[model samples]
Target: MRPAHGPGGAARAGDLPVLAVLYGRGAATPLGLTDTARGRCAVVFLGDLGDPLVAADLAPVSRTTRVVDTRGLTEAQLCALVVGLAPDGVVTFSDSLLRATAVAAKACGLPFHEPDTADVLVDKFRQRRALASAGVQSTACRLIRSAGDLAPALAATGLPAVIKPRAGCSSTDTCRVDSAEELAARYAEFTDGVTRPRAYVLEEYLVGDPSAVGDFWGDYVSVESVTRDGDTRTVGVTGKLPLAFPFRETGLFVPAELPADLVEQVVRLERRALRALGVREGVTHTEIKFTPGGPRVIEVNGRIGGGISDILKRSSGVDLLAHAVDAALGAFDPPEPVLGLDGSGRRVAFQYLVSPPSDACVPGGDELLDDLYDIPGVDLVDVGITPGWRADWRAGTEWILGTVYGSAPGFAELRITLKAVQDRMASFWSEVEV
Candidate 1:
């Protein structure tokens, strides 16, 4: 990566600080976000009531909270609404709303990624262009909107390249194509039978170091960072469990048991990437992999990583979610992540996602989950799959049936605990009949 490089606010009712959150099916729930801002400030949720995703995104509304419905409002109207709220700060956890939040924040004179930066943040094609233009990365990337574009994209990116929605998240409709024929097929599969074809990005795949990660772990890691007024602090490097199918994440642990040198290397690259992306404030989740050439960036997320807050709180007692709230409020005092603390009896904290096998209906139930609690080192089990539901690989990572949170003394111990859990959990999933 290469180097590259906001606010208004006022107290509202009760003379307390306020955080204006553009809420929907986003990173943190209303309940979860409200909890984070409880003592620090008051939270006002700006709900896009017209969006279908918001119905599931919102937890039950509480009496004390106010949900502002911004559906059918123009961008200027939304900004005016935010200005009227007079919040001390503004923030968003949803990828799709980053730009809208930025616009609103700007209207209210609060700190946030600028609208221009947010544009690049949400659009992969623009981000790649910015990264390469700034010498952060020189990876070849092309945006394709039709079947005719696939052959040229494949020719430019070469075999074993990646094809994913240019502006999508959670790896939905993502695939790896190793040949021109495969690329064409995947392109058709993604575009055919749909009224309007989605734009896609084709880029060279960065190879990972299998030896560096071992069999049970994925070949990548994520650097969780907090940037305040352009001064970024490294929170911690997170390691991953092996991926499911093409690219579904299984497990993630913090205080990633990496050597001091490698950890520093990862942090350095992360800082550069953040700078290249013009991130001046708020929290970021930057994924990187150990390549034979060196550490390379996967992508940079402008919000807290999914399932990361739990592991981070467990590992270091750091409330990353609160950091996002505080950063928006311009009152965040982030602590440098405690490094090399996994020695002696120190433990590694992890969040394990349980995804069902493709083309199967899981026999999941409350009683079936009860057996998971007894596994040593496994702290909590939360599975939402009903007795009969399909799990499709095409559904991507959102196809989660359950999640397992736990801690172990080290990587070796964590592996044993994970295997024990997976082995037992396997019985809950029944293969589909042909």
Candidate 2:
């Protein structure tokens, strides 16, 4: 374990809340939680990524890092480690570790998602069942265990259905099957990389309204929120810039360009769905679609939307990470009143620089970033993949070369600005032989 305050660190952030962050499943850079946390910041990270976050990453943020091999550690053992930290709260950003962290939080007597109910929050099949039981309009779903199980699951979900891992992220191993043959072919393709077979969910397909398709407004949007003691409040809604196939996210535009009334409807469904899932507290990222029948939930995530914390801050003037930690520490008050969707400005957006299909080696990231920074309205450029990395389209947006974030004065201007930057960035990559 590392010291609470690293050498020369501020003597315990005065009276601000101290948080034990189970750092995993987020960007390498420090997040709003680590940045805005007031008191002692202790991080327990699992992995051999030496000095998981380099000093350069932490130069701009405040946190104490403890890299541990948590692979085989029991929830209780992890809790004991966090308990020793004497933290006011224990929380995690990783989807893969949410249940364990919830358990650890419970063992430490901290405010968090209840340990018992946490599983349903991350397990897709269980989520569908819970939402259905609550009369929330989620897709009908069936659990798939093997090839033979697909027929029954397919029957339940219908043709042109969706199939995805019950416990998956980054849209990995997810697909849309339009026919029995396609299901068989894509099932094998989707399941190709499994080391051990896991339960999957075959769900009814949700077709979004085609009319809503525009330059950036895709068929769906994600609702950003924070909850406390069974009551949830909206942070804002984010629109997608048309995801890659098999459901790879491309970008998020905050304060989704929708009529104010429809955004309210989405919020209504989100609150009802969260209540249904028994998400008593913490932050949530719920994706909903503009279906022909109106907005219906696609899925709900019981954490902050990865990579969009800055967007939330830009649009809503609230730090979601700080708010979430504050909720966990039971100091559940917003520094500034959270803005409603209407109040959340329309300019904030984040765009990914995806790996193009061509056999192209992108220009050196340092050079490209310098070019991107020169673009007007480009506020932030995060290079995910460097120039030497080969692009593999078989994977999802995880292959994106980088991400760009910015805001303009209005929706139209923001879109135009992003398009201009994107256009300017188009020629920065050139093909290379394999």
Candidate 3:
């Protein structure tokens, strides 16, 4: 196994180390880890590409360290790289990769979280089943491995159902089907590559206002503090605004507009759902809908929610990334909420800078980042666009053009500011060509 270097530029041959496996290069998990430890610890980068910031983030910690770049490697090859790292602990944000890593870690006699819990967190179908059996209010769902299984599943699930991949992220292969014919047509779209057999899930369509709660669970109960055994801290909540079809996220407003009672109810539901899934420790990103009956569970992710965390921290003055890493390292203590702030009643919005379809134009991320930074009270501006990456304007994925965050005095002021910023951004995009 390759030995990583400590913060002092010396080799960590016989010392305990923490391993973080990232699914993609642009993800915020690594950055979160770095912020939490402040380059005082060791880390490993596992992904197709390495972000310059990731290297920059770790450079201050140590000059010489083990970094296993897993780009273009098969699963077995990747496993070999992880084994070579020989880490005492492993951390992952990708659900699929987490499951695989858990198996490998267990076989190598490493103490780690179980894969079944991770599976239940990632696989929407499995999560729904577990929640339903545990008496949690969840949307009706059926797993369909083939077209042969589609009919029975549909009959069991009624009309206006949502069809999506069982383990997919970013709502990549999701579609809403109102009838059997629509389901067949949508199913045909998934007939290639990783989705060929198209192991899909059909769920009863839910309609209502949507919200997200970012929580952390401990050994005994869900709390705001990290436990000795890596229990997590449940922090503030952020309300999500999604686009029309496939439910791609559009914007996020910190500190949801719901009443205090509703917020408590949502928290209780999150605790119940996590307990049922056996997720004792770690961050949870849960999506739900406030229906006519009440709040219903949509899906729960074991890791933190992408992009939303930035807004939560920006508005609430709490760093979720730092807390997550501290919790994972058993050095976390819940900080008191930044209370009596004037920003609570105001709406702080994060709008995605997306390109419109027509010209194959690419966004000038650096320039936009600068513009957002210059804005007064702008909390964070994350540009997810990469050079040479094609932009499908119609694609129902959260490819943030850029995020603009700021607070308004009230809902009316929030609306005006949001529109003004959005219009300014739209004008900027109009001037650019493909």
Best-matching candidate per lDDT: 1
RMSD of each: 5.1, 4.3, 6.4
lDDT of 1 by residue, 142-218 (tens): 99998888888887888789999888777788878888888888888888899988799999998888777676778
Better of 2 and 3 by TM-score: 2
Ranking by TM-score: 1, 2, 3
The C-alpha local distance difference test score for the whole of candidate 1 amounts to 0.80
Q: Candidate 1 clash total?
A: 4
The RMSD (Cα, Å) of candidate 2 is 4.3
Better of 1 and 2 by TM-score: 1
Give all candidates' CA lDDT scores.
Answer: 0.80, 0.70, 0.59
- What ranking of all candidate models by lDDT puts the best one first? 1, 2, 3
Best by TM-score: 1
Question: Worst 10-residue stretch by lDDT in candidate 1?
Answer: 1-10
* Candidate 3 local lDDT, 307-361, one digit each (tens): 6556666666677666655555445576553222344443454444353332344
Judging by lDDT, tell me the better candidate of 1 and 2. Answer: 1
